[model samples]
Target: MPYRHYLLGEDQKSLLDRLVSQFTLAEESHGSLALVYLDTFDWRLHQADLRLVEEDLCGKARIDLRHVDGTLLASGDFPAKVFAWDFPPGSLRQALEPLIEMRALLPVARLGGRRDLYAVLDRREKTVARIEFLAPQVRGNEDNRQALPPRLLVHSLKGFAPEARRLADFLEGPCGLTRSETGLFDESLAALGRRPGDYSSKINHGLTPALPAGQALRQVLRQLFTTLLANQPGVETALDSEFLHDFRVAVRRTRTALAQLKNVLPAREVEAFRKEFAWLGSITSPARDLDVYLLDFPRFQGFLPPEARADLIPFRHFLQRHQRTEYQRLVKHLQSSRFRALVCRWRDFLEQPGGLEETADGMKPIDQVADRRIWKIYRRVLREGQAIGPQSPPAELHELRKTCKKFRYLMEFFQSLYPAEDIGRLIKALKGLQDNLGAYQDLHVQVETLGRFSREMVAEGDTPAETLLALGRLVEGLDRRQAEVREEFSERFARFAREENQRLCRTLFKSSSPEQA
Candidate 1:
């Protein structure tokens, strides 16, 4: 454990000298160090109580991992270039891989400073504790450094708590130093006018129940725009599949917002955006589909006998080749001027005040709008679900799936208007049903895709029979799973359509007048 005490007075050197005398300390190495704090745009590392820093000391670069409180966790020589995958195989990589899976590590703040290291000596001349006074001479944006006040740190070595406690008491009583509530990295960030949790892509508009429908929707659109822009860099770099996933989700939500709150925005503009985003969504789908198959390749292989699993290598290569081709197409389109203009126009429209002149019911309280829409969609879901029998056509189920998606989006958009617990229960129930339907549809698609691959391989005339056999087995396994999921659909839908959930939905979403506009 490490204990930290901040220097409160101007006499930091005096305080250190006093400590050297009182603890019978000896001078240790003292030098200048340049450090850069790193995190994702969303601060994933900091949120997990981890801090990663790249340090340059004496012309050597190293990365250090520490807790928020300044206790060192691990450190290793910095790689020549750092990527999410560059960390050598070790505990540090193991810890970081999950926390920052697909996000890039960005430098949050940079600090260049000098330190005076002192060791508290035991009677036997062994080091018992250590003290370092970090003098931050320059901080913030590297191009324009801002000098900051120096501060002292006390590090307690293991098994020497009593001695460290005594030194802390002396410093607090006579030296006038107080414990710092802020960490060094946080202080540096503040100097640069940033905070740990400043940015997030999650939709949190802080909408109120009484906000006008048009204004509330504009706020939602603004947030979605921000989310879309935030993920664009990741998508362009192909850092991870989630960037594209998030980008596509934002597009879908934007389209959904336009349709659901159609009356609030100008109909022509809304329709135009919907069409554009539909195109955007269409272009992004191939890459995302390929990503899903690549991600699920392991699971697909697991369905095959161990001895035959290697036979799927050709399929893996086929998927990768297609994924690369589709990803390149996606990147080219995303980087195009057309895509840039669309985002700018969408952003400008959403940022406009009062959002187009309100249509009939556009000025209604958002809660009222939400109540009417939620009740209508919920009823539609019920009507459609009830129409599905054991022998219902797959087309009917697909239609129900789309309805559930609309219902889910509405609940999510207006969630702030309702009791969170009640809305949560309703969404949960809907999700269970959606999951079953989604699985059923996805299985069918996968089976069809496998069959197509098998046919293509046979036409190529250079493929092995084992690969085809493996694809057949994979399709059969998926079919079996689809059948099982189909069998469970009744139970899942029953849970979603239970009396308790229905009562909650009706009580929460029942409207005062017929849904209008």
Candidate 2:
């Protein structure tokens, strides 16, 4: 049985109410179509992972996406067939993401006598997929397909991509399947050349350091990445995006874990990953930025009317063209052999059991790996902060900020084994430090971008002077807007950071005995 399913709530209701007079997909054949049944709540969370959303949007859950699925499933239970796939969790997350985000775009067809929601065909009109709930009358017949009241999900797909796995993930990622949906998902998968426990071996780790708890949290970062990148809502193929997200996560986690377990893994490997990730993060920035810009651009435009928009449009065009070219370049960078080799090496590293070297004193290395290094990085950052003067170079300050973030995340990830309150305090202080530095850096980037754009727009005066003047005004407005935010930001930061040293001391050593947070 598929673990989840996605159905139209309105259609489910209509069908449950025996009111699905509008659903034509059930009676109709959708050539090469697929339908996956997903539990609305689980699917969205499972689809758009918390990390990506948090990093991209907010620290807290966004209500905008919350309950979106249940809301979609506004109606009650209906007899439905679900198509299930037996794919790796990673693969499954990747495939079904699109449907979660693009439900509004899905074309509805009816199944059986119901009409509200039934089948979906892909963008290209090659196939149609519909799901039908078992008839109540036939559901009691044990010998028939309706006997189990199989929750049904159905799908039609083109060549090459495994339809069952792709379809199953699509259905199950957010909305879980019903008892009946599960039955149908299983039945459908069997029909399409898959059975339970059928799938490729999962790559469980990619550049991770053993935690102080030893192997308990070995691949937390990888898991985070797998959940985020693999399940991004768009893109035709699931593997690429999933892998990308996982890879980014693996990098981040491994880096964090290394900081926490510096005593275990070779320091050089930790440094190497940190350096590589800096490049990887840059490559991914275009994609991530584009995503953010797409979300907020309309709002940004709306802040001013067409007059302001007309001024900013050229800058927008420049931004778009630059982003496009940069994206293409980023894709190429991802495809480069160097990148693949790094991934392969990372995979090889993760497969090995690392950390905890046994010594002559009969002491376990992992014991020290967690305790000693955790406080050590914390101490170093604090000392560095004290030692560095206002005359410190930006490079030094930037390094300091990176160290704080690393330790902050480390504390959070391993809070299960730490003095929670103190670590939380430290995290807050580090955040203040980062906020100040980050805002400064963002302003710098904006200013630099503006200068470049101005030159490009003003070249040879091909367009009217009004457009240039408007664009210049637009950039000035943005700068002014940013400057406004910068004001009072420092005072808040200073208040938060003044006692960072005391807070770190209290948090790191708060426990009287060895205990987990």
Candidate 3:
């Protein structure tokens, strides 16, 4: 059976009532339902065109996964679960785990109301279709409530397609009802002063070539600042690792912008903020490191023999204990006056208008500045990548990694200034190299981190001999993987530095003319 939902327009309920008088409508069921919509902080499910709802009807709770168009894909009893992993092994868990990943499912919106169900009958008194009228109120904080527009749902029975079509046509033609495009999720979100996909970690500000470099830098900085503030509460609450991850990324991007756009902002202010952001990033590092390890604990266990996997349990416990400790220190630092002052001062500086002319390039057209910076960095990446040899020290690769990050960030920040397809292609090309480098660094970091953790565990006298051996095995595996990744870097960099990409980069970013815009 197909599910259809419509919103009742002005006085349409009376029109629907008058039209339904021609048929025999039998009351099926009615109840008050408490509906709570859930999604990740970044709206991952919403981006996928799916919504997860936990509905309570007369004390019975069920979690449902549905399309944006009111089609139910899966449903199960709503157990006391906060994350995908907490759910028992089932279809709902399977559908959610891949989408939500490590993010916690927070209640995005809540609505409370009564719904009445009626079965539509033909002259023969045979059930043809069912109708549902939902009148829900947005349940908000502090006993605040807002009424939403009423909704009508017509559910087509399996063998009654014609009747269902006729009913829908009648509703559309005379009842003055319209299909709901935004659906309840969006409506409720609106009532709560939020919109779907309102938050994202990616840099996507639109910039024009004619804009002043100072103004352009401010726009990007403001967006990054908003992302930082938006994720702060989630970080303080330790809701999920992604919140911290996004927060850290935003901080890093801010630092990059400050460092790379030195001549676009006042040097003294830029240096001050860069140092503060660096401090911020440093304070948040321990918790994030532990988060990565904990999130990858299963994979770590998989590297060992089945019987030996149990030996890592103590290590898992060790990580958990330290994760809690680090989170506490992290939250304290985030809530401190210094962090607050940094945020306030940064916001004030970004919000200011037209005072950055003291710097060298602040008044230049953004296109000219962007072209020069991007071209310079692109050449630097090429030079650095080409300079690395089979005997190059690991430190060389690390330096190249940092340079690649700066290039990537600059490209992303100014992507809108170039042809979308051309710039997108270049970004895609760089990502391949970035992924290889990222993997190599991660493997290297994990090996060193594991050794440090093993030493810490021994000092604390909490880890057993088996756990130590397990940690040793994990370190060896990581070392091998890191070497393999390092071995692949040459080919990856070769592809990135290929002629086609190089040519495209030169054609797109190497020009400062108005034609580039």
Candidate 4:
């Protein structure tokens, strides 16, 4: 596998304590790892091609090298001796050779014996080092990816490990090859002729930090979830993709927490939590699907002519009404205090020394806690639903619905632990059920939104045949989804629902062993 190495800089001058050459194998193409020390080199940065830098994840940066080619090209201490220009097509090497002659080079004598200072080494290794420098949080990136060779694309300072970021603190600046990146390059170059390893296992191992299975996995999840939540979908349709991602993560983590720290939780509790997550994922499916399909309509319409779009009214109208219905349900579930309480409760449960249900499922100000409480609420709903008729216990069902939402929230919250496949299956099933429920719900809401439109049309006295037709189409679509809930659908859905409910409770109450705890 191709291992990745990063040398992040807080400034343009990353004074990496570890030399680069020792980090790589002597061979031209082999993966190696280390954190050695090196000297420094002089490099120049340009006002052009700053775009070569990665997007600023450390907030923002001051390095702005604007150019038509969208690249910043300038020689730092390790100046490229312009021998030829036959590289990437359409390059400007030919036009800039005269300016790069050694005459144009700043004299080493005048440079105060800067004398190409670099990390001294006796061996060479094969490793590529990339660096990114972000300014202070107020204006993050200073050097970013600009100072290093373009091959080493700097993505974000935030992505760098803590130690790397600490090193970057000394590297960012107006100069190219932040002191840190320069130091790495100098070290690598210095070791050009030396053996790859110094023949010491302790030294090699100490140079590299290895993440253990326990905490490291959690960290990766945290970073990933942070990324997903940062970009919310515009409409419901996009929710599925996010839902899938979030739900799966929760599942994986749920399993991981269960297996790794078996002592921390009981097996039953882990199963209960997983089950609830599965159910929660199921209920949220229709809303996401409806949202996604409807939101994409506007773009899809662009492909048609005006006349075609005019006739497309019924389709668009149906989709819009569908959206309103799904939205109401989603909002109701999201706002339920029951779900909120569960999040706090779940967090408490997870953080505690005991297992999932050492205490009763309690409620709290949900907005204030981690997302798992909602999922517990979801489990609660299924339990409540088990006791009453779907129609007779409207109040109970409504509360049940609330619990379903809580589950979704929880699944989304602890998604870092869940598996993607598990979540995907649950989402598919929920979508199937939601398709019918969502339609019924949409009709329930659209009747109101369209009623006003109808009144307006009547007041204007317009011959709005399309309005009636559009409304009819939507109503029909809703009817169609419900129409199929017959023997086959009933059997399949019923079986799935039973299974889902079981899983919810199973997942809710899962636990681990004391030793593993």
Q: What TM-score would each prediction reach against the true structure?
A: 0.87, 0.54, 0.94, 0.32
lDDT of each: 0.81, 0.45, 0.87, 0.36
Better of 2 and 4 by lDDT: 2
Q: Which is better, 2 or 3, measured by lDDT?
A: 3
Model 2 segments more than 4 A misplaced: 1-250, 259-261, 267-278, 285-306, 353-368, 376-400, 419-436, 457-467, 498-501, 509-517
Candidate 2 or 1, higher TM-score: 1
Clashes of each: 0, 57, 0, 109
Q: For each candidate in turn, give its C-alpha RMSD to the true structure in angstroms.
A: 3.5, 14.1, 2.6, 18.7
Q: Give model 2's TM-score versus the native structure.
A: 0.54
lDDT score of residue 433 within candidate 1? 98
lDDT of 2 by residue, 226-329 (tens): 44333333221322223334445445665666555544444555577657766776676665454434434554566565766655555566567665666567
lDDT per residue as tens, model 4, 1-517: 0012234433223332232412221222212121111110111212111211212212332122223232344212222222223212223333333332211211111000010112122235212223322221111124122122222223222233443343333233322333333322233323332222221111001111132222332333344333323322312233223343344344344443343333224456556654654544455565655555554455434444455546545555565665577666755654567545544555554454243234222121122122233344445544564564434423443444444444543444344344546655655655554444444444444444445545554565643576555544544453454344322333443544787645743453233211111
Q: Which candidate comes out best when scored by TM-score?
A: 3
Query: Which is the better candidate, 2 or 4, if ranked by TM-score?
Result: 2
lDDT of 3 by residue, 357-436 (tens): 77898999998888988888888899999999999988888888899999999999999999989989988999999999
